[model samples]
Target chain A: MSLFHPTGPRVGSLLSGSIRQAAMTVARRDHGTPSESDGAPASTVVEARTSGPSAAPSLGPSFRSSEVIRVEHLAVSYRRSDGAEVRAVEDVSFSVREGEFVTLIGPSGCGKTSLLRVMGGLLRPAAGQVYVNDVLVKGPMPDAIAYVFQDFALFPWRTARANVEIALQLKRVPRGERRRRALDALDMVGLAEVADRFPRELSGGMQQRLAVARALVSNCGILLLDEPFGALDEQTRLVLGVQLSQLLESAGRTIVFVTHSLQEAVFLSDRILVLSHQPCRIKKTVEVPLPRPRGPDQVKSPAGQRIEAELFQLLYRESLV
Target chain B: MRIRPASLAEAYVEVGPVRRAPWWSPAGGRARLRGALRGRRLRVFLLRWATVLALIGVYEAITRLFFAGSLFLPPASEIFTRGMGVFVEEGVPEALQTTAVEYGIAFAVATLIGLSCGAALGAIPGARGVGRDLLQVLMALPQIAIYPIIILFFGIGPGAKIVFGVTHGVFPIMLSTMSGVGEVEETLPRAIRAMGGGWVAVTWRAVLPSALPSVLTGLRVGAKTCLLGVLLAELLSSVNGTGALVMMYSANGRIPQLYALTLGICVGAFAVNTLMTVVERRLTRWRG
Candidate 1:
């Protein structure tokens, strides 16, 4: 749809052959895709992926033209009020190519969110640095990144449309223009009708969708989703997962998602970065050979199962369970 | 005695047969009455008026029958009619004007200082603990005990009343605001920062809006306390203002006139509280 049309240099290549192929798949179905058909098998395939590896050689060089986010030996630590020190992320290094979907999946409280925060410049890393579009990430770079928090950090006092308009307002967009853009963003999320409804009035799934709309309206090249669907039920998660994949297909923005759901990782990611328990480190980077604008049946397919099994085994081993 | 079943269907029934009522029946009428009262706004209005009229009726009855010549408890009708004469009494209007000015200035000053100080204390980590402790200490003090000190500093004029009012009013607002600002979720400010908002934007957009309910609660409490402080100052000084008028009436044993003046004060307090409530509802309409 034109709603996802290129608004900046980042999305300029959205209509290119590869991305169009994905957009076509999205266009073939309505917003509520029939994801229920494969729900059972799709869920069972969670967390299985290829053997331990940094990156698949075959997929390299094809999309390495631009590295939008680079995390170099990034380490994060927190200090307690009682003067105790606790390490969260340790020596984590990775790079995300433009328009790639990278999923950070790990056990609960394993610092995936901490790593995402560091990349978004919401938190200052104790060691190393993050670079977004070649700019050092010492602090928030709203121009380059938009973050969707796990709890759907919506402003309770503002309606859905107003919440979406906040980032634009911060950027000093004209009132009339921001209004239009906000409505358009809400429409894209199928929430145009409830644009005037406060966050508290929305359902859990709708709230998450509204949060996504807010992030989208920012029009940032890099989207950071910290377990955006973690609070949702499994059924809603699957549906939203499918819808998000389609939306990202058309938007063509690089995404760094954090989640604990194996099925979600398998369904939405181009690469799954399995993280170890606290003092988080990248345990393995599994590349999904599955094509973009993934079909509903893909998660239940043999290849998807193979990848999920590998991921599950890796995490199972990492957890020492 | 032995009884036989009327019919097979009746025998199979678990309980006695149901008796349906017609529209004119008492049961049906009562049900309809309940349905009518279910209209929320109408019911609330009726209930409120009923309570007020009942209280006034009882007070009038008791005073007229039992305390017919009582100087301390005059009839409600006299308070409304003869008591209202206090409005036109000499110096009463001037005292009202003085009180109004004092209230307006004190409330405005308290609101501004309370909000700013509260936001600062709440937002600044280093200041939060110390600010909280200081506010607690101030809140704990018997504000009335300082009336003499205020009188000495500002004299018996409106200055003393305003200052006293502010002292009485500012603590609730500051404390409420501090807690309100402090209670704002960490994610909100983080969202603003991620959107490239600096300290100013975070405070204005995130901190202020999020802390508003608490700040408003503080303001409401402060407003009431401030009014009390000013009135008490005037009453104690007994030199000028509405409090002085009240003191004069009571000292002279103008029982009806005193009650009338007291009733007027009650109305004024009610009006102020009502105005605050309306404003609070209007601003927080988004909360719905």
Candidate 2:
């Protein structure tokens, strides 16, 4: 990679210090190649290439560039209640490939949630730009993206199916079709039987599932999840981690997951972007070359464990910052 | 004899190593407890009425024995001696008729104005802070002390009485609405906005339903106060309403009919309060 020669120098890139130098230091990750990081001890990329063609859903001309989302040196800051300026996200740059399940992992209060909010156009970045589906995102585009919140955020007045229906309702889908699609999404999440149940009536795990179903009910190509399983127990988390991976896989959707759990990131993600503390920055990106149908054993394998440990070390050091 | 078997859920219980508390007793035991409760319910009902009857009896006996001839305190028997007679002979109905009509109009209009103003203040943060200070100040001020001026401006008629009633009744509704709108969760608005909802949708779908229970409570408070305010204004001027006749009867020391008329107005006010309370409870049934 050339040290200086490049396309028009983006002002946001200067704030991150460098673009060309940073690109060269990182491996070839612009495309969904996710090149497998060979067994080089302490190599920054603790990952392997994704199973390319199997993950590809469309053969259309639009599939030429696999990048579905690009965060161009984003910086987000806001004023605190004490009237002090707090920088939430600082010069965080990364790209998510189409049909990829990428996880943003960091310690608590590290701005992973802020970054996720920025991606969904819920919060504006102070500097830089976020491009989703090749268009600059200025505000919430329900048709382009769907968000699943940690608290479930399900409408208590609405039934499980009606909650899901709202995703389509917002898109202006006809009532009949919205209902049909809602039921189908519920079935995909194994919640079809409880379609009429109110969100308050459901258990913690079920409520989260209903939220997931709501996200799916929308035809949005990208799903943004912020700690969707953070409130669940160990047993439910493990089960959901596997089930969610399969659900997203079959649906051929791109998902950006925000989480604090290193193990969860390793288990579900095609690539894991470890974020640093407070004013969050991308610390490392790990690729899991582990084969499909990842069982508990696969997640607990030596390779997975090594990548998880590396992420933990980066997180621990960044937590102090 | 047993009426039925324990439910399927109840049948699965394993015996505890130690005897459990009666509070943790089986569903079968609950049925027996419920049956016993039914018997006690009737007795409780009788006992409640008995308590009221005993109080009235005691009051009548005490007044009859001590100071029976005093013009101030009247015996219960004497109070009801002209119970039906007061309605026809003393013009009690006309007084109550005027008060009821004025109270109804004042309460209804006050509620409409109060809810709208309160909702506006609550939905907007800047308005809420200012409204909170101003509303509390107005509600705290003794409106009774200012009734004379209200009558001087509007005159001693139903018009003045209604204006007083409305002024008194409007605050609770406004206060309740402010708090109710505040209680609506922030998440609902974001969700609606994300789904392409406009301001109208957010106000109607999220703000209104969320604030409903408290608004109903405010309305109930408004209704009770409206009646009191109208009566108070009437009492100040012996021109119209039950307030006017009550003043007239008391000045003449007609204690029995005065007591009876007072009792009727009190009962009517209580009935209105009960009705509003029932409506509020029904509207808030969705609350867990």
> What TM-score number comes out for model 1?
0.85
Candidate 2, residue A100: the lDDT equals 73
Cα lDDT, model 1, residue B130: 92
lDDT of 2 by residue, A171-284 (tens): 678998788878766765666666776676566767887899888777677899999999988766765675576455544577899998888888887788888777888888
Compared with the true structure, what per-residue lDDT tens digits does model 1 show for residues B1-288? Answer: 011212233233313234346559999887667766787766888999999999999999999999998889988998887888989988888888889898999999988889888887887888888999998998898888888888888988889999998998999999999999988999999999988999899988999999988888788889899999999998998588889889999999998889988888888988898898889888887785
The C-alpha lDDT values of all candidates are: 0.79, 0.75
TM-score of every prediction relative to native: 0.85, 0.80
Q: What is candidate 2's TM-score for chain A? A: 0.80
Q: Which runs of model 1 end up more than 4 angstroms from their true locations?
A: A1-22, A25-64, B1-38
State the C-alpha RMSD over the true interface residues for candidate 1, after superposing those residues.
22.2
Please identify model 2 stretches exceeding 4 Å from their true place.
A1-64, A171-180, B1-50, B64-70, B77-81, B88-90
Best by lDDT: 1
